[model samples]
Target chain A: MKKKKMIISSQTMELDVVRKVEALSGTSVRRCFQCGKCSAGCPMATFMEHPPNRIVRLLQLGQWQRILAGRSIWYCASCETCSTRCPNKVHLASIMDALRKLSWDAEGPSKESYVQLANRLFLENIRSYGRQYEMRLAAVFNVKSGQFLKDLMLGPKLISKGKLKMFHQKNRNMAEIEKIFSRIEEMRKKGEAL
Target chain B: MDKTLNYAYYPGCSLHASAGEYDLSTRELFNLLGVGLTEVPDWFCCGATPAHNVDELLSLSLCAKNLELAEQVDGDVAVACAACFSRLKFTQHTLLEDETKRRQVEKAIDAPARLDGKVKHLLEILARDIGLERLASAVSKPLSGVKVACYYGCLLTRPPDVPNLDCVEAPTIMERVVEAAGAETVPWSHRMECCGANFTLSRPGVVIQLSNAILDSAKSSGADCVVVACPLCHGNLDMRQKEIEGVYNAEYGLPVFYITQLLAVACGAGAEKSGLGALMVDPFPLLKVKNIL
Candidate 1:
């Protein structure tokens, strides 16, 4: 892992995109003055290349590409510890969400696919069954991620304990749930909602 | 305390399947405590962490839709899962503060976003609505010798002014509720820490490491069991306890009990009624030793 030297200039800086992030998260990236409080409290900071405060600093410098390319935003557990502990009220958790959303919309160059895959399947489960089927979610996640034997040993024990259900009961209001999804899609298409 | 408290129950997705015991214990405990909980009819998922992780509009709309459904039969909306509780409260908070987002969510749901309905986690219901004094009176079998580490995890109280359930930094709702049931709570360090949440499915290695730290903290604190409100926390702590132990090469056989499960058991519900057998780590040994069962 070679360190890429950061070059800050008008060409490299994408302030417009940073503004979009600020708009989406409804928080200012400028407020984070490298306080390091967010990174200190973040549980997943060890797993991230750039910690929460650094992510905000990157956003402030319009270096979101670097933040998104790495696995920092993906590794965030969204524990809201950063948001809760921020002395500057930066709302780092929501900023992480905004970055993830933008990266997802771009079909991201992120190296972390397992987390994105799991999130996709979770949202798909909701849209399809109007609720989450944990058994199906885990099974499909295992299959898609090519980790077929992942959690295989825990399956029988969970079933024996009646923790995992074989069949999920679909919500009776599936039509309404579908409508909500479709309406949101329509709103996004018309640029009526972010 | 004499007044009958009724609420429209939103069990969330986990409650129906993997966290069935939590749902069972909630119903049984609420019944015994005389708190009326009617299931919100055909409630869809509140979009939990995933929806909000990517699409805030979808998350707000999903929770807003559920809030509308909850208005059908309710005093206030009662939520079991901490994630669901957080999302619902967030939707209400966001919609109230930002009129533009509220209008968009209403359009997405094709109904007015109902921000007026009170969204409460089960802890608030037990501690405030039903009152802890009455909870203590209802305990038939006092868990006199059982030591508990009440794990709040995340989402219960964090980021301040959102859930408003208790003090965001140092919440004692779980400890207070468990103590009311005659269980002693240990002053552990990792009670408010994250349990790697949904990563139990995505990045299990992370869950193992984080949950191991939590388990180690509880075990070192001289706790017999870890009590939790969130099902995901329970899963990471209980379902993966053995795996975590193997990964860390340490032994921590602490049983993780949902708050409702422990409360129901203390309130005279049998093992079957409380769904104690659903737990992966055997809690019977501790219960029997404490003479609670």
Candidate 2:
């Protein structure tokens, strides 16, 4: 394996990009000392292309494009292990969250589209019914993501036990929820509806 | 009458669907305990794990709505799912601490940012408010000699400062509650571990591997069954137990129970009301052998 080093270079380091990540996450990136505690405790780090600490290091080096396009952000389940384990309180989970949003905005299409699809379906269920429609969330996510039959066998088994309700339980506060989504649109500073 | 205890119940998405067992057992157990639980009318989703992965404002807005709804009622809000409990309590902590973030969330939800109501997990209710002594006395069936591994999973007590529900590193709230039900909680390192939550769907392979680790620990620790406070953890550990066994080429006959389900049975609600039938990995065989079923 070839050796790689993190040498500080003014030409490669973009402080503004790091500042943007700090601002978006509302967490102090400056507090991280490369201690790797966040990466150590992360359960998803093994599956990630870049560990949480690596992403944080990239952010420190202003590699916004690299981090945004990476699968590390999409894989983070936001278990908060990294956030809680960090001695500096870096809140790596929040930074990973910011990166996920940025990935959707900048990267166009993600290989983790099934996950992205599910997130949208989750929100859409809430937007329409005032609460998450779990059955429909799966149906929509499967169909839209082209991952049909994902839980094909398990679905019937769960339904048989009455675990997955077929009928939707629409909350009476549907209009109120709609108003909130709309108001959020007006309040958004990111200028992106999604 | 004025002294009657009450709690506003917020059964999140899973409780209504996948984790109906958790909901059923919670209500059934609480009913047996004589604690009044009223549903938080028209409560919405807390966005769970996925929402935060997408957008911050979206995540905060969804949780804030439920918090606002809870404000309409009187006493503290009670929840069965750990994810919901964490989201509700975490949002409250974040909003109360950061004025700018609070304002943004309020603007996003179009609701005032005041979590006047206390959001608590069911374990907290059993451990703190009801007290272990009261819980122990209420147990009529006494899950006698049942070895339980009370899995807190990820959310129930992480991000130490935010929830502050118990000792973050070594939370025993679940264990304390299980002990009250006459079950011996096995000491294990995987109690506070992550079970790949929503990734159970997005990344099934990852879920299987991670869940196997938890199951391995529970088995090695001599636990007869695994218990959880989160529906996602239950789904991964219980629903995907077979897949985990197949992947790792091992058998984990351990039945995963919601903490509430264990309490429901111990309090004499019977297995019928405990939702034991809904479990993907059957706990009945073990329960029958132990005379708990």
The best candidate in terms of lDDT:
1
- In candidate 1, what are the lDDT values of residues B86-165, reduced to their tens digit? 99999999899888888899899888888888999999989998899989999999889899999999999987989999
TM-score of each: 0.97, 0.95
| Chain A TM-score, structure 2 | 0.87
Off by over 4 Å in 1: A1-13, B1-3
Per-residue alpha-carbon lDDT of candidate 2 for residues B1-293, written as tens digits (9 for 90 to 100): 22467898999878888888888998898888888888988888787877777767777888888888887676789988888888888788877877777888877776687765788888888888888999999888888889998898888888888778898888877888898888888999898888888877666788888899999999999999998888889999998898789888999898898888888999889888988888888888888888877
TM-score of chain B of each: 0.98, 0.97
Interface RMSD of each: 0.7, 2.2
Which lDDT value does model 1 have at B248? 88
Tens-digit lDDT string for candidate 2 (A63-165)? 7677766667888878889999898888888888777877765743456666777677777887888776778877777788778988798888889988888
Candidate 2 residue-pair clash tally: 0
The best candidate by TM-score is 1
lDDT of candidate 1 over A29-53, digit per residue (tens): 7778897999899999999999888
Fnat across every predicted model, in order: 0.90, 0.68
In the order shown, the candidates' DockQ scores are 0.88, 0.62
How many clashes show up per model? 0, 0
